[model samples]
Target chain A: MWLTSKIKQLLMVMKPGVVTLNYPHERPPVPANLRGQPVFDHQKCIGCGGCSDHCPARCILVRDVCQELRVMLYDGSRCTYCGRCADICPEQAITMSNSFEIACDQKEDITTRMELFMMTCQRCGRCYEMEKTNAIDRINLKGFRYDNLEQRALIRKTSETFDPTLLQQSDQYQRPSTKE
Target chain B: MSKRKELEAKLIARLRDDVVCVEKTDPRTIFIDVKRAGIREASKIITNAGARYLCSVGYDNIERDGTLGMIHTFALDDSDQFVCCRTSAPENDAIIESITPDLPSAGWSEREVTDLLGLRFAGHPKPKKLVLADDWPDGIYPLRKDVPHNLVPKGAEDVAYELDEAPPGTKIVPVGPFHPSLHEPEHFAVYVDGETIKGCDYRGFMTHRGIEKLCTTQISYNEVPFIAERICGICGSVHATAFSQAVESAAGLVIPRRAEFIRTMMLEFERIHSNLLWLGVAGHLIGFDTVFMQAWRVREQIMWLCERLTGNRKTYGMILVGGVRRDITPEIADDIRRVMKTIEDDLAIIHRAIEKDTSIHKRTKGVGTITKQQALDWSLVGPVARARGVDIDARRDHPYAAYDEMKFEVPVLDSCDVWATLVIRVIETFEAIKIVRQCLEKMPGGEFFVEMKDSIPAQRHAITVVEAPRGESVHYVITGEDNRPERWRVRAPTFPNLQAVPLMLLDEQFGDFPIIMGSIDPCFSCTDRVAVVDLQTGQASSISKAELDALSRQQQARHASLKG
Candidate 1:
């Protein structure tokens, strides 16, 4: 009984229900929600260094040089691919791409670079967040609108004003790139 | 009337003078600050009160208070209540009485405390290098604030781990710092009297990548869960979920109900894949590659399903501190059920074949038998305990995530052997499928994320347990300033189960070592996180067979000289 059943089981397994994927030549079916190469939307990136703070592996680097420009460098090698940067981005700048096959021989191949102009907080007079993204959503998230009305009004009032020469700060931050 | 209060009262009553302060952190957890002098007695009281010893966390709080802290966590599995006995020792003379003499399960933990935090355990049976590389210099404690996490001592001295000498009349058959059987770098000296295994001595922790030090020292609170996911490739979600829950609990952040349900679904999904993978590995261990191939074939479906559901095939980085990153839509729910059904069908055939097959039964049945008493004494969890009829599942006992809402069976078999463990895993896989189906059916709709607006103050400690595929995974988190954990200790299921392997391997045939180890579903990646020195030569690298033999001789001489 055991031998016959075992033979039957072996034959059943041989029915070709289970199959191996033909890869390299034939692409493996990647799901729509697959977290792959981190896509940086340069337009939406406010250079607040939020992604760096949210990154668990410290794969993201946001260095604000002399309060003029914010240099954001993402080393994909160091990234755990947790997609926290995409999830926690206040302006929804970072999102995951489906291109997960990020294998490369050279170090430069995996590195992602995005530079944005630094914007200073008018109230604190300290450089805070990346420039060019709407700051009202953040004000709401910090609960400043409900918690303190005066600070919210000040933030809103400051939003109307900007450094006239801020547009001429750097050509690097003005690059129209949203590479996924 | 409450079990938590009763346990606390029992602890305080037994050690009235010893209990300095009993702080009820939550309804289910109590932190009893007991005198360092009476720590052993306090621990014994908690254990005797039907609380299983979870793990001990040793933290170096020298910067703030000139003292080291040790927290012994115990779980009264029935009431899902956790009792943590906190004690402190002066940094200058950081010494605490070891509980290992009574609770043998805490042996490795105490040794680890001695290794990483440099806290001396007075009565630890084998107080040796449990975490660090053997060649690591004396007085270079990695976890201490003074010694930075990345500080590699210039020219680390070569001090090989001193392995236990082979018993008289038994020849030592050393198997791996690198062996076919062991997936990771680990040294095991199996003493055999002509194939009848006499005794076993293991010198492992070679894969200790210093994750605890890395995370606590560098990583922030939000990012820790991702690093926790990398702890074990197979059971990454277990660690991630446990660490996230621990952080959330510490901060008093109650996540959304839907988020909890999603977490439950993901964990069960992980269980399905991990169990199938283990079954395949077990098959491979016993020289049945056909079963291995078939099992893996069944498992790949779940892997694909997981990828489809949560982005990645393995490290489903879907979970965050407050909630899951992704949501389970109706379409995804149907997809999960379809995949689980297919896997269920595949596993059924394999299980029946193994059950009816005489060769499998002859090889596995009555081999590596662990009695219920032995299982309890060693504090084994997961299928290992269940196979021995211990009937302890952290899901049913502790009820973390949405497990309380989900209905599933915790299969307990009294056969108490490798065969029983094999059967338990098979049945548990089906149960996991059932759980995932129920989660998909009963999942509530709401926001998947909760933003933590309040600044989590420092020094709030929390303990969280996730019933991982292997067993129960425990994570202890103490919230610190600067948006990071002051101390995060993870006690993986393999950490305790691997300790009990020698007990399982005592007199069994040496040939059955692979299957026995495989049966435990040992995930060294989670248990160890740094480079460990070899037992013989005091180096981290694998040496030649001849060199290893010579080192074994040196170890033997060292033991002989000490004995003499």
Candidate 2:
């Protein structure tokens, strides 16, 4: 009777098809929209410091390292993952990734870094970043499909050091769709 | 005039000129400012006329009004109107008449104002230190404007939390400050004589995070919603939505219809996860492992679905001030329908298995009971009030969000026991599924957000309520200068329900303590910053047992004469 009772209890545990997962050997399926650690595209980042200012956790930091250098530091462990930073970003450079297996033994492994170069204002001589503002204006005036016409106007109007090839290739500088 | 207007008219007639002024913010709210001397009488008049006492909010308005401010909030369940009684006392001579002598449920709210704002309520029955830690020094109220938020004074060690005196032969058995049965740190001193519990006392608020002061002093208006979402882990969206709704009401802003539907959908989604979590916790407290495992296995899929909708499973930071951050697309609506169907199927199996079990019936039925009259006297809410045949739901009575358009019934059982509380939760889960489907089907198309360019003007007070899974969560927001609320008071449903636990523990088996306390689904962090500290410890006198019996007899004879 004791052996039969034990066997009966074991069968009942399997009613929900296996309760525990063999986590290391076989992974569970995560949804596509799961908010993991944030990923930053350095080419599109403007170093405007909006993400650092609006972050509730203060996980993102933008510090002026020198006359022409700005450093952005992010600590993933302190992040509440509320997505305020990504929403407030001027350029859509920061997006939440689907890689949620972010466990680490070392504290330094949780921190990420990005560096940017600054430009000077023509009138005030104050150091600033002009790449994103100019791009936004361009996206408003010229659509993304007009690469040939915009590049010729771009070289004539601005410095030759400014490159339009990467801007055209990425094809990311576009105004919001007319939905609202 | 409507019945609601008649109630207000009666109060104004009784107090006449003592009611300094009466203002109506909307058709649903009546704001009355009465003389400081007539507050107790006004409260008595309102309670006798069938208005449920909500909670009180206290703030420092010394600079603006030259006195401290206090507002007592009330709601009429039958007519769906909220009434506010505003009064203030001089800062130098800050004393007000107590209402706890008649309205027993207003005890904790009065005590909270006592310690936090330092306002003394005359004739308060058993006043003692609450909310602040035992080792905390006196004369330093955190909510006062003068005190800095980061001030951490050195605390005195070995300060004991004075418990009430043991009743005659019953010894005091302390249960927590942390226990396996209680998920948080709270102390319950149960006075038991052999196998029966004679009396009990509680000391909680160990989870106060000091976020209330931080939000008012440091954070801006846009960031306060994110902080409000962290008030309670299980009911995060409820707090966020309630705070945002209060702000929107104060500023007179209207959101799009689609945003309201999305907000309703998320609130119902939280109801599903929270109710399932409570079921698993209840089963674990009763020493049944199978029910706990099966309930959690069914809950895992809903967590993944929440992650799909809002990116994070638990916090789900989708709600903004006037609207939601993201819209629910057609594809996402279909996905939600599939996940909800699976939950409905799995829940039915667990419900059938537990409903017929003899052990569950024996353990829960006829245990931890409070009468219908006592439930009303204590002003209990949510499922705890519904189980006792008191039909009051914030969603149905005071309809906010898309609940006015959705059709669902408030499930009530008159059993008035732990068993009834469990059954009511199971029935409400199905109602949640039905409401979500209706919201998705009738969702309207419009702009997702209304960007307000005007700054929110100061000194507007709004009271908003949301029916969380456990009970009604009420937030009183008073807008202020510099874009933050001057005072934001949160009265979670656990605050009133937990206060009535001692009444339910009268003359019960000592083994039923955990289930009785868990019946309220207590969340200490939400009702943070104070406790009902019992101070009648054995130091009253070193009197003998025979002398105590004689003194008690004399007191009873005097009380009987007074009542007659």
Candidate 3:
């Protein structure tokens, strides 16, 4: 019985011969639907901040440098590549590229920064419209978002207008420390 | 009378004034609110009515009513229904009776509740900080509404968890934090005399990321499926589907038929890969590298297939609250069928090769043996319980997703050992392939994703179960304001199965520890670190990898000599 079993195992092992791929030299073609690092189209973006609000990882941060310009930053270091931003983008500005080999030394290589020009609402200073019926899909952070860009911190607090005091407070935003 | 009414009548008859009220949230779910004093008796009555214990869920209700709530959930598999016994206590005097004395599986749940929510269980056996670190400051329960999700309290140095006392005359062998055999970070102190095991004590949850608290406080409903998928690398779709189903049930949302079929196919794909993965790992644990290599090679096809279908290899992120995110095109369906065919043929070849191998039988047969009654007592699930002849499969019983229309066989064995688990997993892989074929053939044409018309009303509770490849995964969700769940509790399959490890490890050969633990296919990737300590002399030492390998080899040599 042992000999027969060994013979069968030998056949099984011999059938699948040398399946390992030689990577870096011989590359396999990636599928069309692979959700890799996301690429942002600056001209197509509307500065709605929908992708930032819907992001599960919160890797995308939206900050308003002024009333006219909104800086959207994608920190690839923490990105999960689940592609929620691409799915939720209203203008189809975000696309999950086919680039799976994104290993690099600096985070800036994979990161994408977009400076979008915004047109504010005439009735209100903010650019957001509360017209969506579903409350969960609505963008909660309206007006100028003053997230700390240097610290890569998403300050959940926002102002109705571009307030320098709030921006300065955000600049001093340190993580909550343990009470001694 | 219906099964729900019959159970409700029995509970109300037994505890007349203690039965507060009974509410049926849906047809299959019955929520019975009993007074805190009669919880034990109520649980007994439900169990007497043939209800299998699932898990306990504890949540903070202090902000609204100054009370803490506890719900003990059970499944009436014979009748296809669920019975949830709900009871709460005031925050000032939060003490509830522990059901662990009767249902041993509730031990971890109650301890976890005590650690996270600060709700004490009066008669809990060995309730010494299950989920919290030893140095975690008291009076700071992280699950409460007022506590922030990102609170990092100061860590007190030099404090360590006090493990249970080793049995008399048995040497302690600490098997993890980082052992060669264990892929995850969990510590098991096994008491052994010579080559035989006496008892075991486990200290895990070291890598608990507080996901429940994060999802409840930080993220919204739509984003939770993605986070929930990260709960387990192997069964990502299972957690995501269960969470989405729980929310959908709570909101009374009816998804499209095509979406259900797609969800079912995704779940089956996960089962195929996961079972094959377990098979390979089991082989590796038993020192049989041939089976490991062959099984994993067969599984790689499914991985590539999933990457094409769901846009990633694992964590499909395909499921949402209303429906699935991706639609199955005809070409993708053909691709799935082709992959399933190749996997079926290759797995059969591997199965035939290993089925009659004497070496595998010598290693796995009669190892990790637990009786059917003991398995039921610990509320073990999946292949572990099925191997022990406790026939329960959530897919057929609960019929979630598109399983109600699909027909498949659930293989059960009476061997009650690791060999049976291996055989059952292989058979179930074949069955999963069959289910995927049925799903593709019978899939209806409709919308893949649906938009929620209205906002989910707050304070509605729902529970859902999805049969992960490992076992039954239960998810309970309560809708809250701010588009997030008020309190979401996830009970992974490993939660109950791992609790019964000590019972399975009793009286087994010490050298067979790795294969025995690996028999359950524990998803311990979230856990890390290892140390060895002598309980009698109070001396701490770390065992090197070479020493552990030598020790195991020595034991194996002794066993072989005795057999010869």
Global lDDT scores for all candidate models: 0.79, 0.78, 0.88
TM-score order of candidates, top first: 3, 1, 2
Q: Which runs of model 3 end up more than 4 angstroms from their true locations?
A: A122-135, B525-564
User: Model 2, clash count?
Assistant: 2
TM-score (all chains, Cα) for each model: 0.87, 0.84, 0.94
* Top-lDDT structure, candidate number: 3
Model 1, which residues run further than 4 Å from truth?
A64-67, A115-180, B1-14, B530-564
> Measured by TM-score, how close is model 1 to the native structure?
0.87
State which candidate, 2 or 3, has the greater DockQ.
Answer: 3
List, residue by residue over B275-333, the lDDT tens digit for candidate 2.
88888888888887777887787788788888888888898888888788888988889
Candidate 3 positional error at B108, Å: 0.3
Instruction: Please provide, for model 2 over A88-108, each residue's C-alpha lDDT reduced to its tens digit, 9 standing for 90 to 100.
Output: 666788898888788887646
TM, chain A, every candidate = 0.65, 0.58, 0.90
Off by over 4 Å in 2: A1-14, A61-73, A113-180, B3-5, B529-564
**For model 3, what is the error of residue A67's alpha carbon versus the real structure, in angstroms, after optimal superposition?**
2.6
- Winning candidate number (DockQ): 3
DockQ of each: 0.19, 0.10, 0.44
Model 3 CA lDDT for position B279:
93
Lowest lDDT sum, 10 consecutive residues, model 2 chain A, at A135-144
